[model samples]
Target: MHNLRRIRKHLGITQKALGDGIGCTQGNVYHYERGQTLLPEMAGRLIAYAARDFGLVLTYDHIYGSAQLPPVAMAEVVNRG
Candidate 1:
């Protein structure tokens, strides 16, 4: 089962807050939590790191279940902008 909602609630932050933390909208957070749209691995790691900056720890298991998160290349991401 997806656990973004659980983790967000535990951290006492709203969907909008988490979305802002990760540069997404509240709608995106809602869909991601409900499985309407899959949260990409890179984006998941970004969110995890953002949450960490806020003193919360999240992981692939917490966000993407038992599956492993694929490695992300910072170069490609930086070049996209």
Candidate 2:
């Protein structure tokens, strides 16, 4: 299983909220947690949302978990909570 669900739950955000951040639907998030991987753009957007809104640092590897995702550069934000 991907860390998407875990991270979202940890952040206390709903699928619809996360999907809105990444420009997807809640159903898409539902499918992503099952097996599908997020597009690089969407992943980056998620990372940004996590940082800007939730003050949580996130990365492609963090989001993909054990999935074989290529490395992508993204700025991480230190938790301000």
Global lDDT of each model?
Answer: 0.60, 0.71
- Candidate 1 local distance difference test against the native: 0.60
TM-score of each: 0.60, 0.72
Show model 2 residue runs off by greater than 4 Å: 66-81
> How many collisions per candidate?
0, 0
Model 1, poorest ten-residue lDDT window? 72-81
**Which pairs clash in the backbone of model 2?**
none
What's model 2's TM-score? 0.72
* Candidate 2, 1-81: lDDT as tens digits: 457887776666678878887789999999987879767787788889877776667877787766433322232212221
lDDT of 1 by residue, 3-79 (tens): 67765665556787767777878998888778664557635754665445444445666565754434334443343
Residue 67's lDDT in candidate 1: 46
Model 2: lDDT to the true structure: 0.71
Superposed by TM-score, candidate 1 places the C-alpha of residue 15 at a distance from the truth, in angstroms, of 0.9
